[model samples]
Target chain A: MGAEFYHSVHLDVELCKGCINCIKRCPTQAIRVQHGKAKIIKEYCIDCGECIRICPHHAKSATYDSIDILKKYEYTVALPAPSLYAQFNNLDDIDIVLSALKSFGFDDTYEVSAAAEMVSEMSRNYIKKHREDAPFISTACPTVVRLIRVRFPNLLDHLLPFAAPVELAAQIAVKNAMEKSGLPREKIGIIFISPCPAKVTACKDPIGNTYSEVDGVIAIKDIYPLLLPHMKSVASDPEKCSVSGRIGVGWGNSGGESAGLLTDNYLAADGIENVIRVLEDLEDQKFGDLEFIELGACNGGCVGGVLCVENPYVAQSKLKKLCKYLPISRNHLGDEVPQGALFETEIEYEPVYKIGKNLAESLALMARIDELCKKFPGLDCGSCGAPTCRALAEDIARGFAREGDCIPLLKESILSLSETISPNQ
Target chain B: MEKNIKLSYIVSPNDFLSAGAVSEDVKAHLEEMEIDSEIIRKATLAIYESELNMIIHANGGIIDIEITPDSLNVEAADNGPGIPDIEQAMEPGFTTLKPNSDMKAKGIGKGRGLSNIRKCTDFFDIETELGCGTTIRFGIDLK
Candidate 1:
């Protein structure tokens, strides 16, 4: 792994209490409390925002472009994610939101859900054509893709070789903006109204593709308040701006992407933990003859992102209600899948968790870790700053820590030393 | 320097909930050693299938695992009722599970345990005696 790996989720040193909450909750074990503060190993982090969601002190925050970014370009397009539709009280019409986006200072508005429908169509055809490689994992969630890239090496071939809907939407939005406004590509900003920090990192440092078309990413939470008043003003005479239908809007909730594929053989799992379990089972070939695997790092897909404002279940129901009267699908692709929609680069696995540089060194390190583990108590108390006792042993074996770091073992040694030196009292 | 790591686990009888715990532990170790992903998958699958067999059929068992730079070796031994027909038991879909057993409800006994173990390992052997017990041994080459 190189120093080029970028992470959007960062810690606020002022607010951190150096608690073990983040270290324990990180699915990748990327975080560790050292010297009374949490340090995130950049190579190990997937920018999944688990620390952001778990931090009780509000010390963790995601980096994204502010609303002021609209002024940087002559023409700006707001690409609203489907989860953005689920944030309002009674948003029966998607046009109201789209019109408000225009009122919110963007020159034009594009729905990411529209591109999602196209991706769904492309995936269905891909699955049918690649029957030998039946179970393709969804790459819509950047967190899931990064997780697979670092952890699950055996399942790399199964990743759907397509750009995320937001990426495709940005490309189309930029192309349309340049043609309509008679401006150069740089002058037209393709901004994404994102639901999570993973998308921000994905745009900045793309994995499957060489570069992302998205110029800037703004969080839904930051844009929620500004759009509300605009939404209220446009509700009465909203422009007919919604281009997507039920299948597209359904992408907001868990299992929504799989549902759009129109297949009962697919399996959809949400939340990072559940996604890891499914990937592990898939590696062992546990699920027989599945067509597709949809994984969301958040609890209820994009709605449960740490950057979103509404409760995920509430947003899910609202999304269902909003899509109730809409058509099955409004967007349709041609007989051939578009070239721009596919990934241009291959995603290679990064063995960040490997204990050493090679097999011989790794064996030596593993043996030393095992030896250290035997000396330390098997209590997985995070007092040593590591998540588990075994993790502490690994840290010791790597020379990043020492056995004296174990508070319990250190206490015992100190007590014995005092007892031996004091003589019989 | 060459070093061989050894591990052991005692599988409790009918403990369906925690049956795969040993295999998960072994898999974690292999992951730390940076073993090839395919090899880790095969090793874990074979261990998991053998563990399930001990819990579902044999009255618990003891599993011993040895890992070296070149290979992974496992021996699962149990003193439960021996297999009456070795040939039939090795066949796919050949299970002694009752139609309405508790294991069936939990989706455990699919009759693919032994066959899957054999399929995942490079070397596999089984020994059984009518009045005694059954022991299964398997190995996968890491190189």
Candidate 2:
């Protein structure tokens, strides 16, 4: 809402090779490699950060709070993603990481998942109360939310209304800090130490919201070394840490939500493609009576996030070990939750790519889409941004795109030197 | 009243990879044809189950598809042991083929194949002879 154009993902012009790899990979067909570089259609991008992970050049990047920006506030609160433990190869004690975050210049460290416990309890009750007619989608992952916004708009009603662990943690921390010490909201900057760019974008333009509560984002990688020394200082004391129960902290991976809620009909799937397929099943009314579905953008879930230090393989074990016998989830009964704070209420949704202004116009647009497909055919090789050439034609038909949106044609035009060749000479 | 034009595909048996090919093709074509999303979804689901039937029990078959202004007709005919009892087959959990095509010694097994077809396509029809073959026809109206 800040700019109505705030982006968490961007293509670094210098790093991009104008390759259509991301164009092909984007499920929503939100990208178009027009001119020389790839451009993301702001309206179409759900900010899954699939490009950031897939790009070989490291060209696609998620924006994070600058190191210099830390100076703006009187104090910085570093709320590390639970995925951070997975980033380390042999890290055992959560305290070590907690101490290290202190070294990185933070007044205190908040385990974001601590608040997720409250969310877990609340979501469980919410699902139970609305069991019969609810198709509540998990709200833990921003990329998944974005995917719903751009691709599965029809199922938005199914998305459970809860602040993600990160948002919840931020709100709790802000509230606790204000109560404990009379600090102004502006004076305390709640910066999320994120494992993936999606979180950065989430904090920037949270889906289901007019504005994000997260003020800034810090990449775990940027602060990993800065906090390592503090881990040495606090090698013994476990009391100073925010060690959340395994069931709550276990929320990082696929199926974890169900594992926590303990619902028989729940489903959890990771990876953008897998999530989309599951969403399709949900849209088809497959899990009509199901209680919940957990979807993660990365393959093994957050452990698989691109920015983490450890491979998803190892994080799997670390997270498992950390949460082996998580305590019976504490009932935090809703804390008089503010009326306007929910992500579901904050974010607004309209169809991702409207076919037309009105029903008749939409019919006309469909006719146009048919014409375009007749011209382009349906091999969705992503040579065009619309997934299939057929989809591109439909966009053209709907007046959302044009023939010039195709990069191949532009490439051929340049090679043929159609504009520069001097026939008169 | 409906008028339709369709592109048919012949599915090959035991080709685990190409099991869902026909449905995939129909889905792509519907997009190209600019069919309504709801209509495309219903037709695709119906055709997918029909196509999978040819793969699972029919040892492969030809899917004759007809697309029209008002409806879509998909007829999957195969050269395999015809259904011994249409009533039992129609009932959910009565899979003549393996359970799910995936978990079976073959492919795609959740026993949801026929039930899925019933759940998807409207105007379902079936024709078969004991040792000869089977023919199934279904239509989806574009309302």
Candidate 1 colliding pairs: none
Q: Of the true interface contacts, what fraction does each candidate have?
A: 0.76, 0.00
- State candidate 2's TM-score: 0.78
lDDT tens readout by residue for model 2, A22-139: 8888867778775667888887776677888778888898777776677887876778787776666566667678777766677777887677777787777788888775768888
TM-score of every model?
Answer: 0.97, 0.78
Best by TM-score: 1
Give lDDT: candidate 2, residue A306.
Answer: 70
lDDT of 1: 0.90
Instruction: Give the poorly placed runs of model 1, Cα more than 4 Å off.
Output: A1-3, A423-425, B98-102, B108-110
Per-model DockQ: 0.69, 0.11
Candidate 1 contains a number of clashing pairs equal to 0
